[model samples]
Target: MFRILIVEDDEVITKALCKQIETWGYIGKGIHDFNHVLDEFNEFDPHLVLMDITLPFYNGYYWCTEIRKTSKVPLIFISSASDNMNIIMAMNMGGDDFVAKPFDLNVLIAKVQALLRRTYDFSTVQNNLEVHGAVLNLNDTTLNYENQKIDLTKNEVRILSTLMENSNRFVSRDEMMQALWETDEFIDDNTLTVNVARLRKKLEEAGLENFIITKKGIGYRIAE
Candidate 1:
C-alpha cells in the first residue's frame, strides 16, 4: 500500500482528507509542525503528497520546491487557490497534479492513481546516470559517490545531467538554463552559478573534485 502525506493546514479538512485517503487503501499521514514539513516528508517517504496552497508557516509552493530539492515524489496541489497562475506555478515547481477545493474525493483519488501509474509503471526507467564512480539518481535527485548519497536540487540534477550526457563538451549558460525547460521564465545566469557552486561543493564532499570545469566566458563541462 502506498503512503500518502497530507500537508493541509485546515484541521477539519485535513482530517477528512486523511480519512478519505485511508478508505482508498492507502496510509495517510499529516504533519503537526508546519515549519518542518520536509522533516516529516523525509521521515515518511510518502509515495504521494497532498499539499494545500494555504498553510501556517509556508505555502505549498515553498514546500514543493523544498521537496523537489531531493525527492521527485508525486505531488498534487489541493487548495482553493485554483487560479491560472497557481496551476502554472505548481507545474513549474514539479507538482504532478492539482485539485481545487470543494472537490469530489473520488476525482482526487483518480488523479492520484493515474499519476502513480504513470510514474511507477515505467518499469524500465533509467533511474541513474553514472560517470566514473559517481552515480546520479534521477528519480530522487541524489548523487551517489564512494558509497555516499549526496542530495541535489532539481536545478543541480539538470545541470549535471546535461554535462555528463554530453560528455566531452562545454555546455553554455544559455544551454544550461534551457536544459531546465524554462530558462527566462524561472532562472538566470546568476542562479545557474549558485546551483553549480552548490553542486560542486556537494561533489567535492563526495570526493569528486575537479569533476566540472569552467570554460570562463563560455560555460561549463566535465573534464573529458
Candidate 2:
C-alpha cells in the first residue's frame, strides 16, 4: 500500500484527512514533530507528501526543496493561503500540486490518486536511504547530497547499498566480499578493500564524517 505523509499542523484537519486516506484505501501518517519532519519523512519513506504552507518552524517550501534535493516523490501543498502567489511559489518550490485548505475530502483523494498514478506507474520503486542528507538513488545509482549529485560506480554502489541496508548492523569484511562476489567482476581481497576505502573517501568528501564505522575485527556498519 502507498503511504502518505501529512504535515498539517491542525489536529482537527489532520484527523479528518487521515480518515479520508483510509476511506480511499491508503495509509496516512501525520507529523507530530514539525521540527523533525524530514527525519520522520526519511523513516516513513512515504510515497507522497501533503505539506502545509504555514508551519511552526520552517515553512513547507523549505522542506519541499530539501526533499527535492534527494527525491522526486510527489509533494502537494495544502494551505488556506490559496493565493496566486502561494500557488506559484509552491510550484517553484517543486510541489507537484496544490490543494487549498478547507477542501473537499473527495477532491483531495482524487488529486492524490492522480499524482500517484502519474509518478510511480512509469517508474521503479525508489530507494529510501539517507546519510548526512545525501540519498542513495537505487534506481539510477546516483548519490544526492545537499543538492550536489554524483554518479556511483558499480562497486561503490553495491558497497554503499549494502551498508545502508544494514545501517545498524555490523557488516563483516567477509560479508562485503560476498556482496561483491555477486558482481560480474571477480573480486579479490585487495579489490574489496580498495573499493571500500574509495567509497568511504567519497562519502567523507560529501560532508559525511564517520558514516561508515569500523567495528574492529567484527566488520563495518553505518552507525544509526
Candidate 3:
C-alpha cells in the first residue's frame, strides 16, 4: 500500500484526513512534532505528502523547498489560503497539486487518487536515504548536501548503499564485500578499503567529515 504523510497542525483535521485516507487503502501518518517535520518525513518515507500552508515553527513552503532538496515525491498543498498567490507559490515550490480548505472530503480524496495515479503509473518510485542533512539519491547515485550534488561511481554507490541501508548499526566488512561482489566486481579486503577510503574522501569534500565511523575490527557505521 502507498503511504501518505499529513503535515497539518490541527488535530481534528489530521485525524479526519488520516481516517479518510486509510479507508482508501493508503497508509496515512500525521506529524505531531512541528519542529521535526523533516525528521518525521525521513522516518516515514511517505510516497506522497499532504502539506498545510499554515504550520507551526515553519510554513509549508519552507518544508516543501527542504523536501524538494532530496525527493521528487508528489506533494499537495492543503490550506485555508487558496488565493492565487498561494497556489502559484505552491506550484513554484514543487507542489504537484493544491487543495483549498472547506473542500469536500470526497473531492480531496479524488484529487489525491488522481495525483497518485498520474505520478506512480508512469514512473518508478525511488526512496532516498538521508543522514544528518545530506541526502543520498538512490535513483541517480548522487549525494546532495548543502545545495551541492556529488556524483558517485558504481563502487561508491554500492558501498554507500550498504552502509546507509544499515545506518542503525555496524555493517561488517565481509557483508560489504558481499554487497559489492554481487555486482560481479572483484571485491576483497583491499578493494573494499580503497573504495571506502575514496567514498570518505568524497564525503569529506562535501563537508561531511567523519561521516563513516570505523569500530576498529568490528565494522563501519554512519556517524551518529
Candidate 1 runs further than 4 Å off: 1-46, 52-72, 81-100, 103-125, 182-185
Candidate 2 collision pairs: none
TM-scores for every candidate against the unseen true structure = 0.59, 0.57, 0.57
lDDT of 2 by residue, 121-199 (tens): 5335545577657798865567888887777776788788788878868998899988787654789878988998888
Superposed Cα deviation of residue 30, candidate 2 (Å): 0.4
Give the better candidate number (1 or 2) by TM-score.
1
Candidate 1 lDDT tens digits, 1-224 = 88999998888888887888889898998889999999999999998999998898899999999998777788999989899999999889988788999999888888888877655543236777888888887766678888898887667888898888877778888899888753223787777888899989988878899999998888898876
Indicate the TM-score of model 2.
Answer: 0.57
The order by descending lDDT is 3, 2, 1
lDDT of 1 at 51: 93
Expressed as tens digits, the lDDT of each residue in 1-224 for candidate 3 is 89999999999999999999999999999998999999999999998999999999999999999998988788999999999999999989989899999778889999889877755542354458887888887656689999999988667877887888788999999899987875435788999999999999999998999999999899999998
How well does candidate 2 score on lDDT at residue 141?
A: 66
Q: lDDT: which is higher, 1 or 3?
A: 3
C-alpha lDDT score of every prediction, in listed order: 0.84, 0.85, 0.88
